[model samples]
Target: MPETTLPRPRRLLLLSVSAGAGHGRAADALHAAAVAEHGAEALHLDVMDYVPAAFRKLYTDFYLRLVEKFPSLWAQLYRITDETPPDAAMARLRRALERLNTRSLRQAIADFAPDAIVCTHFLPAEVLAREQLRVRLHCPVHVQVTDFDLHALWVVPGLAGYFAASDEVAARMRARGLDPSRIHVCGIPIMPAFAQTLDRATCAAEAGLDPQRPILLLMGGGAGVGALDDAARSLLRIEADFQLVALAGRNEDMLARLRTLAAEHPRRLFPQGFTRTIERLMRCADLAIGKPGGLTTSECLAMGLPLLVFAPIPGQEERNCDYLLENGAGLKAVDAVALEYRVRALLADAPRLQRLRDSAVRLGRPHAARDVLRQVFANG
Candidate 1:
């Protein structure tokens, strides 16, 4: 008889955190896909939860505040570490950050002992890369870049593969001297739900919104921003005769504040707080008004809804906005005044709005999530 081996289900570990909502959600969708394909027993952990409380606060909360509130510092740090064109000096800092993060990361690896480690955050990826170089790890480690462009922090030296959101990101990686063979432009890892299109009027009506008027959906990253209030006032000040749906993400205070402002204009404004029904809301909207986080950009593209980007973070989001602008996938609002003008200009011209919608549709890969599934399953 021919030699035969039983099909084995590899134990996979998905490592991520809730720094922003995007990273955790991407990991969740990927893990669900892997479990459905591999088995229900696969393990996943938000690495923030794996560490001590003090460490979690530093990694998850404090880091985000520093990046958002004092972006210049972060930019300056990036320039120092990543502007060197992939030299030894840059690698030293990269590995230094790895070692700093490894105190808890090593523990997680020891406990999980996974056949494969899929990281949605850079911290875990760096630790794994350093471990591979220092010690012999029997399994492979993959990092999924959860943005339209990557930061040097995410660039691990010895990764088995990189899952990128777009071709522009892949090209940028090549510019950074990464091997083209190691990068896979898998699009952003979104839920399969984004693939199913819903009728515009039906979705709008179902969401208790107006189908006849232009619908503007405003959001910040999960941390939320002061920009929404400024944008809302500007949208009204410009006499925008439209229905507005503003999603104040996880900012209960901002949501409450917006609700108070929205009360002054009942028919035109609708503000929501930390909604889980994002896909439904996206289907109902005419335009996505937010920062171009990788997952949000991908979801918007798949929905064929155009974008109006405002207040993009200085690093990855700026790169994302540039990509969208370069490709005519979206428009940028440099400030509240500029944002108002753009909104009025776009909404007034039906043909131009339609053109943007068409561009968004053309840029979309509805099967991106499925393509990722195919690649992961085939390779695994």
Candidate 2:
């Protein structure tokens, strides 16, 4: 009998943008899962890095500034963009500008020659789709929608497939004329750590939290744009027997303020800076109070931690909150008072909290990253 040899692992190219944390995190999750679980060679790149400095700053910084300083205005822009047809004159002009700025990305993609390409952000997918219109791409290109909502910008015409965060998003893609077979609703991909079975007591002890008391985890998104200090102070004032863990991600000023508050509250409040052990802290949490960013929400759900969304930014975060509320996995608080009230109520009502946790566990897709990899490489 002739000897049989195994096939080489598939090469994957995962592209994302630095406009915000969720997309990059999603790409990173897919990359980690591909290499660790499937033994595939993976390369991840920030699309902004291939563009000109001026464009990169304008693209990323402008979005951050808009979302932080003028959320209402950002919301308006988001609505307008979402409502605009992809083939509209303004949309075409914007896509043309994006393609012009991302010429170098084409060369980078050609150099890698990946067997499959997955984009967690729409920009790289749009660029590649345009390139395919001009020249044939040998590899399959798929766009993963990181948010629960699908925007028109993500509906690029020429692509192999789309990975949606939910079935609703997949339906939106279908309404946009996408082939049903190409849309995969696999939830948002999260880090493998979230899928692990971690002991809550051990995790709580690691974070210096008491497992005997309820733990409320509060966080802004990666940039830490929320007024976490005020929220923490409000949460501290609640007449409850629970610990609050506030994570200020990469925001030095917010972290300092949090530490100062922790000093005042002593063992009751814990302030954390950007940490890689988020999965552990999440495991310790009884409830999470944060803006429902896609990746963060997915992480919370994966951990079976119920969310209490606070003043979600008007577009995607708001939609994400709605999804949680509809699915009974989370609650929403439109103001600080509401947030405090909701937290107090949920903590006081143990059965309700347990129900929320049960719903979250039911909705969680811990193996979404692996599912994505398997689906994309099934034929390969």
Candidate 3:
């Protein structure tokens, strides 16, 4: 009889850009799912790390500064760029510049020789798509659109598949001339911990929160950018019987400010810095208050925690806020006053809050990471 040989496990290259935390977090989720659930070998890389220092600063620092200090301008740019045709001269020039700066990333991809590649950011996918036009890649590249909205930049040619956050986004991808069969609607991939069943009382006790009172989880995304201090103060002033858990991610100055607030409020307010245990905190919270970045909202939804979105950044975040509102999973507040009012109202209406949680449960895709790995490998 002829000898039978077993196939080797698949190797996955997960690429993300550090423009913001959501992309990297999505890649991390996929990496975890690939190795732990799918029995695949995965290597994750931040494409910005391979770019030159000058380019990296321009790409990352400039975006942060723009979105934080000049959000209106950032919004305008985002709209204009998204409206611009992919084949426009300006777009072509930008893509050329990105390709020129990312030679090292190409070399890394070549060295890894992965069976499949997944990108959580558009930048690397754009670069690889352009490279594929010149030289065919050995592995199929799949892009996971981390936001509920799909920008024109994310609609690159020569990609094997796209993982969308919603059916709406998938429709938009098809409208942009992508093959309908290539789009997969698997909500934004979040950490596997969010998928696990956690006891609210246990999580609350671990975080030094009272499980009896309604806990409101506040965040300002990974960079801790937003009117978090103002929003926190306003929410804390509310007369409702609720506690607040504020997460100041990767912002020491913000953390210090939050700690001061915590001291003033005592046990009423809990301040946290950047943490890998956000799933734990979400598990304890009755509501989430903050900008609705893709990953944060996904985590909240996974935990069946309703969101009170405040001042979402005007581009994708605004679009995300719209998605939540349309889906009955969240409410939006245009300012501090609105935020306080909405929180107070929701606190007073237990049934309404529960309804929001129900909606979130329906929308949440806790197993999206595993689904992505399954589909990517199944097709590969």
Q: Which ten residues in a row have the lowest lDDT in candidate 1?
A: 369-378
Question: Could you tell me every candidate's TM-score relative to the true structure?
Answer: 0.90, 0.97, 0.96
Whole-model lDDT for model 2 versus the true structure?
0.91
Supply the TM-score for candidate 2. Answer: 0.97
Clashing pairs in 3: none
- CA displacement after TM-score superposition, residue 37 of candidate 3 (Å): 1.2
Model 3 misplaced stretches (Cα beyond 4 Å):
1-6
lDDT of 2 by residue, 313-336 (tens): 889999999999999999998898
- Worst 10-residue lDDT window for candidate 2 reads 129-138
Stretches off by above 4 angstroms in model 2 are 1-7
Error of 1 at 230 (Å): 2.4
Query: Is 1 or 3 the stronger prediction by TM-score?
Result: 3
Model 3, range 83-193, lDDT digits (tens) per residue?
Answer: 999889999999989989999999999998899999999999998887777775767899999999999999987789899999999999999999888889989999899
